[model samples]
Target: MPNKKTPTIWAIGDVQGCCDALQELLNHPEIKEDEHAQFWFAGDLINRGPHSLKTLRTIMQLGERAVCVLGNHDLHLLAVYAGIRRENKSDTIDEILQAPDVEEIIHWLRHRPLAHFDQNHLMVHAGVMAKWDEKKTLKLAAEVSDALQSKHWQKYLQKMYGNEPNRWRDSLTGSKRRRVIINALTRMRMCFEDGSMEFGSKDSPFDNKSNDIMPWFELPNRKTEKTTIIFGHWSTLGLMIRKNLIALDTGCVWGGKLSAIRLSDRKLVQVECTGKRR
Candidate 1:
């Protein structure tokens, strides 16, 4: 019998509507050689770039070969689609909203999970709370996923915006509970000493001068510390690869390179991006 090839898994950082860079990365000689390669996108797949519509469609066309978690920009697109939030002047998702198959697109986007676990790695768009282990993190993420896919999804979207209940509490329920889960999984960057999320800082952790806040991954006793946690949404932190962590966002929309790393051997691939978010 011919031996079956082991599929290569490429974990990609935030595309952020940079379809040109994304396509280039996918077409890189090393990546294209593996016809059976699978892609894992660390979300923010659209918005803030010149090709939001095409970028989203490209990933959607990948079908079962792609695994994408939800990022904050993606969730913002949903909010704008739901009429719960208005688009900012810099937003680039108007094309997607006006597309003929917008309903289908929204359906697909909303159904995406906030967290994904595979290949012995746990992936989320932002950061995981110190209190939750892999199993608990997936469970909470699923709860938000169910709410987003439910018949009254808009209601959930309406309640989704907020920074309250920053700390994780097992007793949290309803929108407050979902809010915490969504914020931590999608928008979180730093946390107070108590592990309550801090949303104001978008700068790199090293640039953080405050003594009270620390990057979520650096928090003492993170449950997923031993698990290989792959994430993005922190472009300022750039490409960070560690024994137990992979931070892939390289600010593609801000003229940085689009990055992808092979999970098995940690092979890195990158493509330069023209600045799109001025």
Candidate 2:
């Protein structure tokens, strides 16, 4: 019989180009040196902070020991890098795109899964749709992964960016279909009472009180009730501690701090973020 793989993991939140903060987090004492740790990122490793290339290279070097799901910012990085989109004047990913190791980093990043799972929990960039659960998600994520890893994938990645079909259904098609699924996995924010998701809600808890929409995790009778989900991409949601959900965005891109929670012991580690992209 094969020996069981030793389990050690640190499910970290969005890096968002915060290379310094990421360094601090990785060097944190609780990370445990003796154990072979597998790092899982909620993604968004570039844009809006700084040192995008350094951050990407560092993770790329880690290779299979680390896995990052696609965040909205990560998709944006790929888009800009692939010439499907242009970098804004305020963006800093050019450092990554022009780095000597840029192609290698992008190659690994472009192939990253949109969701990952091990024995205990599932990790995604934002939130998963209620209907798919973790197992189903990993399977579907593989489908998308195969699409991304294909030789002609640049066209697919370019095709895979947009927001339509706000709710999941069995019958969506073309780029619009792919884009909606991608957005939900990587960029979801709020949902209505009837379980319909809202793409327009980036507000903090105190920002709005219309009472018609709430964060997906806050929705009553959530479908993935039995599974613990670790997610980021909603800094507005901040550091949340729930019974089965770990929300670790921590506003790291908005002058907040980068955060990582040790899954073995639920230890939260953080480093102050300057929040400036340069």
Candidate 3:
């Protein structure tokens, strides 16, 4: 039987380590009025802003009340921790790396889902592929999660980067299969007409001057078109809400507002961010 008392669900945009803004949003009167409110973080929980450690710890303390999908930056953090990647100059995860609870933090982060599905809504850090429906998306995401949690996780992370095989194929196996899944679920923003993922564009789809590319969601005949997708990661796309899609990344780390939506009512709430752009 379903629990009749499920708490209010708030879908939040990327925090990008702006812990102060996140705190203010959490304490907003409308949100604070509900004692058992649940939070679904769209990812990039840390990086490129002040207080990565505090932001991560704040979410961690939420325990069962929080659900977070791993973003590209989050995966980059794991790769760096595994010594397979170097920290970028814009990265703000060093404080987390230097924390005494670093090991625990990494363990928790690696175990976070790449996608989450509940109440007919699917949430990912980025976009889903045109060929993938909700079930297949969850299955593929679980495969990556299994790899991340396995004893050979570091070896898997080592093989995780690359832009090849930018299109998904059912025949894809091993690291190639994992890479496609990771890229689609965590890094993808735009796609070519054939539904192949494009990694280079950071511009808003409306502002995209190219004729050959379109935002992944606009692809025709998308298998998950009937399922609402709530995602972040493309801050340049800002906040977009449509019948079957909601984009919540509002560039919080770039000094834009941190946004959130109450799922049941689609009520929007936001807090202004003062963080500097990287």
Candidate 4:
């Protein structure tokens, strides 16, 4: 059964290590005063902005009041921590990696869900493949989450990076299958008509479309079309709000606003952000 959502639940966009902005957003008069509000973060909690450690700590401290999905950057942090991947030049995760409670933080972060479903909304860091319905998306996300929490979690990280087998298939197994699931749920922006993803097009769907490329959500016959799909990660798309879709990444770490949506009423709350822009 889907968990019953509270009336004041807020779905927040990608934080990207913008702790100050997150603090500002939370301290908004309405949000701060609402004791009944619960937060559902659309992920990218850490990375590419200052205060990655502080951001993680703050969200971690939220406990049951906040639920966060794992974004591509968040997973990269784990892979780097496990020595399966190296930190890139633009990475801002050193503070998190070198924190005193780094291990504990990683443990908690790795356990976060890849997809969160409730109140008829499915939240992911990026796009869901056209093939999966709500149940299948949730189940596939769990498979990745389970691997992240397993004894050989590092092994999964080793295979986590890559863009292959771009299309989904039930028969796919091993690292190949898991890679496709992780890619679609975390890094995807555009996809072909056949459901194969396009990673290069990160601009607005309106300006970037050709005959073969379109936003994943715009795919024909998408099974999860009936359920509202909430996502972040495509900051260039900014704060997109449609009847059944919300793309809330407003480029907070890129000097844009940090955005949130009150799920019950679809009210938007935005906070101006002055975080470092890459």
What is the TM-score of each predicted model, taking all chains together?
A: 0.97, 0.93, 0.98, 0.97
Off by over 4 Å in 4: 1-7
| Tens-digit lDDT track of model 3 for 164-223 | 889999999999999999999999999999999989998889999998999999999999
Query: What TM-score quantifies how close candidate 1 is to the native fold?
Result: 0.97
Provide the lowest-lDDT 10-residue window in model 4: 2-11
Error of 2 at 203 (Å): 1.5
lDDT measured at residue 80 in model 2 versus the true structure, 0 to 100: 82
- The Cα error of candidate 1 at residue 260, in Å, is 0.3
Model 2 has a clash total of: 1
Model 3 bad stretches (over 4 Å)? 1-3
Candidate 3 lDDT (Cα, 0 to 1): 0.94
Error (Å) of candidate 3 at residue 272 is 0.3
Instruction: Give the C-alpha miss distance for residue 166 in model 4, angstroms.
Output: 0.4
Lowest lDDT 10-residue stretch of candidate 3: 269-278
What TM-score does candidate 4 reach? Answer: 0.97
Per-residue lDDT, model 2, residue 176, is 64
Candidate 3 similarity to native, TM-score: 0.98
Residue 160's lDDT in candidate 4: 81
**Minimal lDDT window, size 10, model 2:** 161-170
Tell me how far the alpha carbon of residue 245 in candidate 4 is from the true structure, in angstroms, after superposition: 0.3
